[model samples]
Target: MPGMVGRVPTSAAAVPGARSAHGTASAILGHPWGGTALGPPDSWDPAVRAVVDLVLSSPVPMALAYGDQLVLLYNDGYAELIGDRHPAAIGRPAAEVFVDVWHLPGVGDVLERTYRQGESVLEKEAVLPVDRRDGHAAEQATFTRGHSPVRDSAGRVVGVLTVAAQTTQVTNHLESLSDFAAALAGTLTLDDVARVALRYALDAFDADRVAFAVDDPGGWRTVRRVRGELLDEADERLPPLWRRVSGDSTAPLAVTARSGVPIFTPDGQPMREHAVDRHDQKVRALASVPLRSAVVRGGLAVGYHQAHPWSAAERALLSASAELVGQATERARRFETQHGTAQLLQRSMLPEHLPDLPRLRIAARYDPGVDGNAAGGDFYDAFLLPTGGLGVVLGDVAGHDVQAAARMGQVRAALRALALADPRPDAVLTGLDRLVASLGAEAGTHELFVTVVFGVIDADRRSITLASAGHPAPLLRRSAPGQPRAEYLDLPTGAPLGLGCRPRTATMAFAPGDTLLLFSDGVVERRQQSLSVGLARLADVVAEATSGDPRALCAVATAAVAGATEDDVAVLAVEYAVRPSRSAAMEMPAEPTAPSRVRHWMTEQLTEWQVPETIVGAAVLCTSELTTNALLHAGTAARVEIDLSAERLLVSVSDSGTRGTVTRAQTDTLSSRGRGLGLIEQLSDAWGTDPTVRGSTVWFEILLPAG
Candidate 1:
């Protein structure tokens, strides 16, 4: 519906500094509310009448006005422009045509300026396109023309003349050009892009609303919608077709693609009526604009408060915006794909194999950072000791990223070497410290250090010796037939390696029948909860899990804690038992006569035991070499033990003689002798003699899986 009109200057064309020459005429129109005139005007001026006649007779369809009134004019096209004007319109002011035009800044100014300047002057154009009666995106273009004056017959400018023509096509084309620019500028996210494109389409046709539908497996689905206040929240719940529409259009992206052209359906019929039975607030007239471009194959629908036809300009604008939307959607998809790849790669970097140790049912697990945002530096490892003890280690690097994880791997490898070389908890730490410090100075200035807990399980001693380098203490669970409880050990309390000169170390000895738990700080640190609280909770859960596997216990503990932790975690558990040595339980002889004899004997024994050929060879070579020394030096039949613990093989040789010197037999032409002890020293883990009541026990441990 047209709004009432008011007179005003054409501010856009006004000179830098100038007043209207026909100020009085403008004043008359401007003061309509002052109660000066009682009713409609009686007649029109001759000049105004001529302009009115031409507008009425032209096929373009037009409106005429003079001095703020719709002047009675020629008859032909005027009827359609005004809809249904009576004979009385001839004498009435043009203000009657509109409901509230006078209040609009630009429209009112143009009217006032023309009325004040009597010498006829052409007004700048105001174009609009109207669709046919049906709701569609196509259009009927219209152009409004006005005339002003420099002076009147009495040398005083007063009143103005105006004529309007419907030129929908050209106007719609220009509007489409502007929509292209707006679509590019107004969108950010995919959803936002869709809405902007839809809104542009509706604005092009001067429709009430715009809706976007995506094709789905089921059908067309309305995914996004935009509209005027009349249907404020109506589109929130879209029709099934609209929601699924995105999938139906094969070239939705192309149609929606920036360079893609949209398929036009000026008629609203293609769009199913949505919520037809719903309340008035939920229903509105609709128009559909189908897109089949390479980028956007989905269809877009424009809704109107009433059934309004589309104008050519409006259709053009809507199509241009659709193309803009298509490109945005493609960009969004690419971003999502890239992000998904990053997450997968990060997740695959963690270790896949876990170490198993004897006397200790060692099980290890790792969990990467949430959503795999970045690589985390949490790690856990277990290996067999020469003495059949389990070597367990857990640590966390300082940062979160692929670089930090790489550094963590380097440190882990260094520590693994140290574990095999020294076997002593404290010695391993010392070696790792040295390696970290000497890892090369040119690798960037950023310092790298790690908090670690390294410990060995002495299944024979029924205890564990653990050393810590500023790491969280391992959890200890002590249990009997019925008695059960868990306690946290105090960490060595020292600085992390690579930062201090002399790294401090503390070693702990696990009690008989106890379970040792090792973990990264992430396991016991939760946001909003103190570290101590988490530790206590973990202890409680482990105690409760006395009857379940330690791994299960860890899971329960993890679940018990809140899910807000931001760190990666790793855990290792080793349970101790008083059961006979793996060798003794398996009924292996405790003594071997000599290296040569032992080698020959093991070949047959291991073959029967189902050991792989390669492994049997390595085991025989290692055992024979160690046994030869005991026989030659100790002067006794050496007791041999081969226990297959989860991870390590514990070997011990005992003799009645006790001595510090382990000399290689003198050889020369009679060689093959001295090499026996040399082989033992080279192959076995840290070898030493421990005095027992029987004599001195010379023993060493080796890993079952040598690598």
Candidate 2:
């Protein structure tokens, strides 16, 4: 109507004026303004009574707003809709009490416009989103809101009245009708599908709790409870939800299972709605919905809270989630089972072939301690490089599980590939360092830094080049006759792979009869002393095991360790030939001779003794200078004597040249131009002048393997 309206017609009866006896429930209950009690129920008009009945009977929560305040309310269900803090909102400002709805675009403005202009406004499907106490998001609900102005007897607008009914439940129903068909696409595991469905149901449909239960021939069992209170305690209470007595059923699952469809229980009740709580209070609100799998016979129960009724939108959400969870759960379960088998397959791919090098007569023993409960990660491998160089590597992967072992295999393969490509000890390590830094260790683990000791042996040359990444040094045995003892070639502790790319290398020359043993720290680190002492002990044992064969030597050395080391141990050994007599002799040619003749003569002596090519060149050059000095200072007639000994080469040149007597000076000076003697002093093992009555004999010795 163009003018202010007094009453609106509907299936409901007409409402009375503001000052009349027909006031809202709050006003009738002695509210300060516009309060009046209706006549007894029997005395009231059937029409007005019917309207009252209709408002009370409706499941949707409702309230009446007169001007700025809530003046009427119906049952407890309607009062609780406003939440605990504001339940007794009657006579309070409608905007203040239900602030969430008052702030909606068309709600507050429409009410204000109706009061000012004496107009009436109608709104359909208004929605309010609210955050619940549990921090979950909830839709306050969809509602049909209307505002109408009330006029006095003189036809003057006095106040505006408002009507609202929450419609969230109805909306959910329609939405779910279409959503259910698309919820479970491509999901193959029951648990996966169930979790997805439960989440969507609780979030979209406003279900209090959700759960998944499987049929086990005889009964049902709850496999998972996505959301629900009392889940741990009330397990096995619901029959239809699960086929076997496995675990608890969530509120939503129990409700749906018993009702054979989604059930709404606004009051927290373990049984039917008609059941009353006579013993106690504090019952929470609850709802339960069932999800049936199209591909499987299992079902999931989705739950909701009791404090609020199910909104229409919420129903739609539950339907959609039901389908998705059913399918997803089945797929996840199957995939998880298959993963175990995959781990076994990976274990087989580890290195199965190890090289057996001679001179070294290498032996590799792999002990993956305590099988079954865990996967093995320790690894060792050796092979002959294309360069006739032998490569040996020993490493420990970061973990002791199957996944760790699998990853270890991959790392080992990469290392082997590098070994095959580079064949050089340094190159292989450089490649490994680069690879791990870039690729990274396995997931669910921190950065990996492996302790590896790698070596390259040139058997023909009797030499070895090795590199270490925080690994212990290899043991060496002096197989050269007198004392068969173990010695260690110490390598610096370079940072492990991916640790600042530090370079490391150490070289050792082995004689034919010497045995070189390379080992992990686990062998000796178990001693009472520190690592240094342990190394000494290893050297001590190797020295003692000189009489044994390669296998016997290994056994005896390993036994020398008092007890087992906590970590694994790896050892490799090589023996070389000894040249004892070659190092015994000495020779010196006469000086003052032509330089060519001196050189020629020095060369003859070195060739005669068959000194190693490395020291031969230097020895020949030094001999010529010493010989020429004796000839120039003491005259051409110099007596030369050569002493060939097992431990060194000693040579002397005696000349009758006298400059008083030349003493080996404590300090070097210009007058002491015997710089040639200084060269002899610096290069030879020992050099001195033996004073004689006529002249002095200057002699020096070059130490051989005796050192």
Candidate 3:
């Protein structure tokens, strides 16, 4: 290939810096194509030399890629286009320098066509993301390239010449526009979308602060600030934050809202001398753009804490950010309005509060699904049935939005009405299914469906009857008094509501220390596992915990799958208490004088049990001190329970009405206030606070003198 170029270049053409002004490219031309298949520059063809001369003289970005491999050759303009891979890129393979372009969707095909077939190619406004560096710094740059063939003096096409310019700035703005539009679609509130836009604007313009505010009749109200220190304009010495603009501008926020113009307040302005401005004096540059929405009108402000030279591109980006804020604000307003109406509809259909059953503790919790602002169909209810039975139901209508929530309300109300008429569990669900089937037919709803489980707990009969309609099974956990074992009660299943099927009921008898848990599918259904797996996890958690408190049981079950569930959740549970035959409990009023009455009541109960005289006085003292503390701190000596056995005398004072913990206080000489918990510790052989499903009971056991 060295002699293939028969004629050699003249001495004037071979001079080092004669052909180009760029030092690196000119030096490489002296020993050009080093180690490459092409020969030295002096033995180069005349046509290649002429093209290289034109490239070096032109200011635009251009490259001469010779031979089939497209070995790289460039001018000063091309070196700047190559970013950090400039100097080493000379005389190297063109594929290595333009490697990122090869990764583009169809760019490699275009280049191969020009190289193999000698076809010219031209493009306009095409998106080609190219990495300007060989390193991991992915500066995503887009470009428009012009490609044509370079021929020898004999007119035979040999290589391709490529002309390209970077369009990263324009592509970046378009990308931000698309990203901001997508974020605004699923947002739940104005604050949600405002935060999203603020984050994008801050990163895009490299500004320190972003805000969306309104100049309402009262004062300036800030919706949010993404970053930087924000001042609270509540001081009497300061004017409103919206009015403290640069120079003599009055209410620049209002002016921007009226004129739809962006206002800038650069650093060292004249009228930034007010106390309001001093609070934020570190603010070096400020730009306010107007935001207009159908529901609200406001202004957006982007600020920098250090000196900044405002550019037209930055101003345009700020305006675009404000537009996103407005559109998102309007959507949030509509969603909030719909969400409020749906919430009211759902709450009105469900019970205001669960009934308080005697000897049975009950607790229920409901949480909307993870989808923002869209109501779900999950519903739960625990009401007193007509025949001294409790009607507990958990239902799920299949959808999300106002329609699903409304259907849930309707089904819940119908279940209540049916149960009140006939307290049978099967009858309640059968009637509900029939009612839903009829309603679905009337509404022409082909997809209308509801999964429900209705249960009746008869305390008088000590029996529970539950019937399901394609719903999650209820769990029944049983443990003996002072034992720590639990299980699940498997109930029969049938078709969901609106699916016509003959349904059957399941009944089981239970005693004290047994718990019944009814919940919606959202409680045990996770995206990653099967429903049965989730149910087994629930059983394991219930077995490991040793509390009969329904709230504690629900808390553990919900926490086990806290972030895993993706639907609305509801949990309802009831636990029967193990009442002791030898214990007597009395409810006492919460008053300053209630302690004396409780102490007398406890003394009489101990005397009736023939408690020894030596410990009866101490037991009475312990009861008096605990009762007095409960009344003083918790606002109530809610209940006092006294139990007597052959060896121990147990007395408990419950202050379940309030939520302050009983703590052991330090000893003080003058003030006798902080020593009650410590003294209670001293008087009893063993003492602990027992938290129940509803409240807590502080109990103490005293060892009776040897009887």
**Can you tell me which runs of candidate 3 are displaced by over 4 Å?**
1-140, 143-166, 214-221, 226-255, 266-280, 292-295, 356-361, 367-378, 384-390, 396-452, 458-463, 468-471, 477-488, 494-515, 521-569, 575-707
lDDT of 3 by residue, 1-707 (tens): 10000111222322434435345456556655647755677767899888888777666667877787777776665655555565677776666666655555456666668878989988655554333333454434556678889898898777778787655566788787788888877677544665566666776666666656643344444432435433332111111111212322354554566566778877644225421334245566778898756556677776777777777877777777787778887777678677656555555666655775556767666666764356788888888866878888888998878788888888888888888999787888888888889879989976888899888888878888888999888888776555556566667788888888456888897678777888888888888788778888888887776455565566566755545566877778887765532668889776655767877787788788778875788777877777765654455348887765444666777775532222212111112232455655677665555433334566677765643
**Least accurate 10 contiguous residues by lDDT in model 2:** 1-10
lDDT to native, each model = 0.52, 0.52, 0.66
Better of 1 and 2 by TM-score: 1
The worst-scoring run of ten residues by lDDT in candidate 1 lies at 234-243
lDDT of 2 at 420: 81
Query: Stretches of candidate 1 above 4 Å error?
Result: 1-350, 356-360, 440-446, 480-483, 501-515, 545-547, 575-707
The per-prediction tally of clashing pairs is 101, 71, 1
Model 3 C-alpha lDDT versus the unseen true structure: 0.66
Give lDDT tens digits, candidate 1, residues 526-608: 77878888888888877876233344444455555666677876777766643423443112222332455566766776676
| Candidate 3 structure, TM-score to reference | 0.55
lDDT of 2 by residue, 227-275 (tens): 4323221122111121133223333444354334766556565433322
Tell me the lDDT of model 1 at 476: 86
TM-score of each: 0.39, 0.34, 0.55
- The 10-residue segment of model 3 with minimum total lDDT is 1-10
lDDT of 1: 0.52
